[model samples]
Target: MSSSQPSPSKSAAQGPGSPIADAAPLSLSAREPHVPADRLVAEMVPPPRFDSVRFDTYIPDPKQPSQPEAVRVLSAFAAGLGSAPSAGKRRWFGKKAPAKATGPRGVYLDGGYGVGKTHLLASLWHATPAEPQLKAFGTFVELTNLVGALGFQQTVATLSGHRLLCIDEFELDDPGDTVLVSSLLSRLVESGVALAATSNTLPGKLGEGRFAAADFLREIQGLSAHFRPLRIDGEDYRHRGLPEAPPPYTDEQVTRAAHATAGASLDAFPELLDHLAKVHPSRYGALTDDLRAVCLTGVAPVPDQSTALRLVVLADRLYDREVPVLASGVPFDRLFSDEMLNGGYRKKYFRAISRLTALARDAKGLVAQ
Candidate 1:
C-alpha cells in the first residue's frame, strides 16, 4: 500500500528550486549558509516522511471538525465522570456505573467524514480545564508511529506529560496496533487518562470485518470499561461547504485553496458564499475570521467557555443568519453504513472518510427557508 501512496499531482509555488527540505538538517544550519549551493539545492526537497502514513498524518481543518458545541458536551461528561480508571475495579464488582449513560461515558463520534470528529475531540482538549493536564490528539496512527520511532517504553514515557488524553480515532486496526492499543489503555488506566474518540464504527463493527467477531468483541467488551460511547450524530459538515462564517476578499486565498485541494468543488462554492454573503455581510468579519482561521491554520484552538471552535460556529452563523443546511451523503441518519468498511486493519476510518463527498453536498441551511 505504501508503494501506492499518492504523490501530489500538483505543487504550490515555492522559491526557485524550493528552499525547503527534510527540515531536520536545514533546521540545524548555522546562522551563515555553510553548505555548498549545489548541495543546498539538491537537498532542499525531500518527499514527506509520512507519504505512506495517512491515518496519522496531520489533517487540514477543512477535513476535520472545527466547532465547539460538541466539546462542551464531552467535557461535561468528563467532568462528571472524573479521572479514576474503572475497567479493572469494575471487574471485581461485576456491575457498572448506573448514572448518566446506559452504555459508556467515553464520547463516541459516529458519523460521515469531515463532520468534525477530530475537530470535536480537539475542541474538548482545548475546552477542558487545565486541572487534568489533558493532552489532545496523539491519535492511533501517531501512537503507532511513536512506537516505531521510539520503543514502547519511550512512547509511554512521552505520554506521561499529561494525565488526561483525548485520543482520536482509536481501533485495533492491525495485530501490531491491537497490541499497542491494549497496552496503551491498560497503562493509561494505571496512569489515569480518560479516553475520548470519534469513530465510524461501533464496538461490534470490527469483529464483523475480520470474521473474528468473537475475538473483536472480547477485545472491546470491557474496552469502554471506564466510559460510555457517544456518537456524533449528523452529516459531514465539510459537505455542508463553507458554512457562512466569514467572507473571502482577495482571489489569491481562494485560488490557493483551490489549487492545493483537488476535487474540492470550490468553483461551486463562491456562488454559494455569494448567495449567503448578500444576506449577512459584515465589516467586522469575526465570523469569517474564525472560519478562515480554522481553514488556514488547519487547527481550531478550542475557545473558552463562551465559544466553540468546530464548524458549529458556522451552524451558529447560519442559525443567527436564519439559514439551515441539508444533507446529501450516504444518509446514515437512517442506516449504520459505517458498519461496512471496504479496507482492512482500519475499516471505520476508511469508511468515515469515504462518506465525505456526500457530507459536503448534504449540508443545508440549518435555518428554515
Candidate 2:
C-alpha cells in the first residue's frame, strides 16, 4: 500500500476513450455574428433626452403637496405605456380596430418651473420599450425642426412608426408652431401614437392673446381634448434658497426665443447663432428652440467680453425655454468673473447666474444616482 501510487482515475486509465478527453476545445470565433440593419440603425439613433431617468430613481418629495398626485399620474402613465400593444399587434389590430377612433389615451402635466415636470416626462420616455422606431422624445421646438426638414406629411409618416411621442416644453407661443403642432398631434393620435406632454400653461390658456384666440383655440382644442389634464403644483425646486424676484425674462422674450430658435440649425449653439444672425435681426434668442439641454465642459472663466455676452444670451435663452444646463470643469457661479459681472451687463449677468443655477439644479435631479 505504501509503495502503490494513487490508482489512476477511470478517465486516465481510459485515455482517449474518456468523455472529457473526446470533447471539442472551446475557442472564440474570428468573425463576429451579423447584426440586423434595423438593429444597427436603432443603435445609431440619438438617445432620448431623459434616457437615464427611470421610475426607480424618481423620489416624490413627501413634503410637496403635488408629489402624491404626480406619482399617481406617472404610475398610471407608465402602466398604460407598458400595457400598450406590441409593434406587431399595433400594426394588425390597431389599424383594423382603430383605437384612436374612440380617442387616444394622453396625459398633460401642467406645473410650475423646476417642479420635476421634465423628470416625470423623462421617466415616461424611459419606461417605454427600447424599440427606437416605436418611440420619440423632444421638445415642440425640435418637432417643428423635424417638420421643417421632412415636411408635414413626411414627418407624420416618419413619426407614425412610434407608439408614443413625448413632448417637453409644450407651449403655444408661435402661431405657426401652434398650428403645426396641433395638427401633428391630432394626426399622430389618429395614427395610434399616444401623447404625453408637460407644460407650464393650461390647455385652454395656450396662445391666449398672442394669436387669434379663437383660431388658436380651434387648432389646439381637439388636441387638448385627447388629454386628461393633471395639474402638478409645487414650489420651484430650482429656486429654493434664492430671494423672491420677478422672472427677468417676460413671455414676449420666451415667444421670441422660441420663434427664433425654431428655424436655427440644431447643430451647436455657436453655429445656431451664426445661422440665426444671417436671417434674424438678433441672435440673442436664436438657440432656444433646438437647445434641449446644455453641457458646459472645460468651462474656464469666459475669456473675453464677447464670449461672456454670448454665454449670457445663451443662458437667458436656455432659461426661458425651461431647458436644463449641466456644467463641468468649473462651478457655474465661477463661469463669469467679477470683471464681467461688474460691466454694463451686470444685471443681465446676475439674472443668467440665477436662472442657470436653477436649471443646473434641475438637471442634477434628472441624473439617476
Candidate 3:
C-alpha cells in the first residue's frame, strides 16, 4: 500500500530501545485462506473472554435502546470506506483541486462500561475489507506501549500504511498519553488512515476532574472534531446475570484445596492471565473489567523479573476491581522473592501485596461462614 508518509525503519516496528520490545508482535491480520474466521477474529481483536461475540449476537439493553442507531452508523461507516475516494484523487477545472470525501472520516463510539463499545468496534473491524497488512487492531493501552517503544513519529509512520485502525478502551487518564494520542489522530487522519475507536468516556468529557481543566478540554475538543460521535447507551452486559452473593469460598481456598489434594489444578487462573495478556498485549490498564476472580496453586517463588512484574500488574488489576484472588502452596508473602520486590517496580509490588493481603483476609471471613 502506497502512502504519503515515509516508512519507518525495521527497528522501529520491532521496538529497538524500549522494554516492551520483548512483547508479542503488534501487527494483526486475518487473510489466511485456511484460518477460521472466529479464530482470526480472536487473534486480531481479543474481546474480554468473549471470542464468539459479534454484532448479530450483541443483545441491546432495552432500557437504553440505542443499538439501532449505533448499528446503523457502524454499517454506514463500513460501507462508506469501500466507496470513499483515495487520498490522491483530484478534480480538473481551471485549476486542479482535491476531490471532496463523502462520508465521515472516522467514528468515535462512546458509552459507559460493559455497554458493548468493544463489541461494536470489533464488528466494524471484521466487516471492513482490507489486506492483512493494511489493518491494525488493539487497545489504547497497547497503542501507548507501542508509541513508547517506537517514538511517536516512527509509530505513526509505521501505521500510515494501514487503511483502518480499530482501538478499544480509549481513555485519557494520563496527560502525556492524551497529548500523544491527539497528535497521532491528527496525523493519521491527514494521511487518510480511517479510525474506529471505542471509549467509556466521551471526547468532550475525557480527563474531566482528573487533569488540568483547560488542557484536557482543548485536547479533547481538537480530537473530537476529527471523528463523528455516536453514543451507545445501554446497561453493562457484564452485570446481566451476576450472582447476588459472593462465591461461598474465596479463590485462595480453592487454590489451597487443589494444592493439598493429591491431584488438583489451578490452570484456569493462568489461562485467564493469558487471555488478559492477549487482550491488552502490552499494558494492564482496562483489565479490571474483564477479570473477576483468580486462583493460583503450587505458587513457588518467582525467579524471572519480567514474570514478577506481570504478576504485579495482574494483582493491581484485581485489586482495583475488588476481584477476589486465591493462592495455595505458598503464602502470599512468599510469592515474590526479596530481589523481585526490590526491583524497578517495587512501589507497584508493594501496593499489590497490601491489597492482596487485605482481600485475602476478607475472603477468610466469608469462608468462616
Per-model TM-score on C-alpha atoms:
0.42, 0.54, 0.56
Q: After superposition, which runs of candidate 1 have C-alpha atoms over 4 Å from their true positions? A: 1-72, 78-105, 131-134, 202-222, 241-341, 345-369
Highest TM-score: give the candidate number: 3
CA deviation > 4 Å runs, candidate 2: 1-49, 84-95, 98-104, 202-219, 241-355, 359-369
User: Per-residue lDDT for 50 in model 1?
Assistant: 16
What would the per-residue lDDT of candidate 1 be over residues 300-321, giving only the tens digit for each residue?
2222211211222233233222
The lDDT ranking, best first, is: 3, 2, 1
Q: Give per-residue CA lDDT, model 3, range 162-197, as digits (tens).
A: 678887655544577767887887777666778887
Q: How does candidate 3 fare on TM-score?
A: 0.56
* 1 against 3, candidate with superior lDDT: 3
Per-candidate clash tally: 34, 0, 2
Off by over 4 Å in 3: 1-44, 47-51, 84-98, 202-218, 248-252, 256-369
Task: For each candidate in turn, give its C-alpha RMSD to the true structure in angstroms.
Answer: 17.4, 18.2, 13.9
